[model samples]
Target: MDAAPIIVHRPRGTGGRRVTVRGQIIGLAHSDRDLIEFLRQSGLDETTAEEMVGSNSAMIEWRGGRPHDYAAA
Candidate 1:
């Protein structure tokens, strides 16, 4: 992933002016998901993968999707 980070925003505007915007960065729990997978393929088990991956909540909240949905898919 790009270490520089990302931005999300909502903008409101009229012919006269603009207003009401919000933004946030989407980031990994640690180095990135690829790094986690690398460790796992190298023999790290699921338990350690969970630890290294940190949190999935970031994606869940950003996507407004439940954590279980990814697994089901």
Candidate 2:
């Protein structure tokens, strides 16, 4: 069976929101630049980081209590 989708809603003007999936923070970016930095900090390749910036949302997979993997959702 497939797992349920993770949804993160960050309200405007709140300095961004913390996105936690399965008790882990998978989404930490609030803007395009922030996303780029986040992705780069997460060890994602340049291509993947660029691709992620174009996406409206993302799906992340956790492993060992950390962001082990992710894909544009």
Candidate 3:
């Protein structure tokens, strides 16, 4: 069976930044290495980037344009 798509909405006005690969967002994040590199470039330094991206499930929610909640999926 195919998997349902998981929606991770990017809040509006995020400096118009979006992750796209081969002209699409889907399948862009195809591996942990890519995610870690993205997090680092997104400003999370090496340690934090590694930790966050290494996890299986990481959910970050924001309120007032800042990270207000985080939890595992």
Local distance difference test values of all predictions, in order: 0.32, 0.47, 0.39
RMSD of each: 13.7, 9.3, 13.6
lDDT of 2 by residue, 1-73 (tens): 5542333334324444444444556665455555555556667787786675565335532322223223222
How should the candidates be ordered by TM-score, best one leading? Answer: 2, 3, 1
The lDDT, on a scale of 0 to 1, for candidate 3 is 0.39
Judged by lDDT, which candidate is best? 2
> Which pairs, if any, clash in model 1?
none
Report the C-alpha displacement of residue 61, candidate 2, in angstroms. Answer: 11
* RMSD of model 3 against the true structure: 13.6
What TM-score, to 2 decimals, does candidate 3 have?
0.39
Task: List runs of model 2 lying over 4 Å from the truth.
Answer: 1-8, 20-23, 26-28, 57-73
lDDT score for residue 51 of model 2: 70
Residue 17 lDDT (model 3): 24
Q: Between the candidate structures 1 and 2, which one is better when assessed by TM-score?
A: 2
Query: With candidate 1 superimposed using the best TM-score fit, by how many Å does residue 6's alpha carbon deviate from the native?
Result: 26
Model 1 lDDT per residue over 1-73, tens place:
4221211112213111111112332222222354345445546686775564466423222222332222211
lDDT: the better of candidates 2 and 3: 2
